[model samples]
Target: MDIRQRLATNLRRLRLEKGWSQEEFADQAGIHRTYVSDIERGARNPTITVVERLARPLGMSPSELLA
Candidate 1:
């Protein structure tokens, strides 16, 4: 899969593994729920800053998620 797809898949997996709903994940990441949904659906190309914000709460690094 492409990077966007991979990112979405990984994000969903991590969130589910932590028993978090989209809203919960979004809150923890300090982002809007709609934006989180867009990311999870692979409909948005997040900037580096956004990626870092997401990765921090997911207990991962931006590079790790990108990889």
Candidate 2:
């Protein structure tokens, strides 16, 4: 999968693994819920800073999240 697809899959997996709703995950990640939805749908090209924000609450690095 490409990076967008990778991010969507990984983000969904991570969020579900944490038993968090998109809204809940977004709140934790300090981003808007719609942004989380867009990311999960592979429709958003999040910036590195946004990736870092998403990663931090998940206890992972941005690179790891991309991986």
Candidate 3:
């Protein structure tokens, strides 16, 4: 899969592993729920800063998310 798809898949897997719904994950990630949904759907191209924001609560690096 492409990088965006990889990111989406990894993000969803990690979030589910943490037992956090999109809204809960978004709250922890300090972003909007819809933004989390967009990322999980591979429908958004988030910035590096945003990726960092996403990675933090998941105990991951941005590269890990993209990997």
Candidate 1 lDDT tens digits, 23-65: 9999999999999999999999999999999999989999998
**lDDT over C-alpha atoms for residue 66 of model 2:** 96
Alpha carbon lDDT of residue 14, candidate 3? 97
Where's the lowest-lDDT run of ten residues in candidate 1?
58-67
Best of the candidates, lDDT: 2
Between prediction 2 and prediction 3, which has the larger TM-score? 2
Clashing pairs in 3: none
Candidate 2 lDDT over residue span 35-54, tens digit each: 99999999999999999999
| Candidate with the greatest TM-score versus the true structure | 2
Candidate 1 ranges beyond 4 A from true positions: none
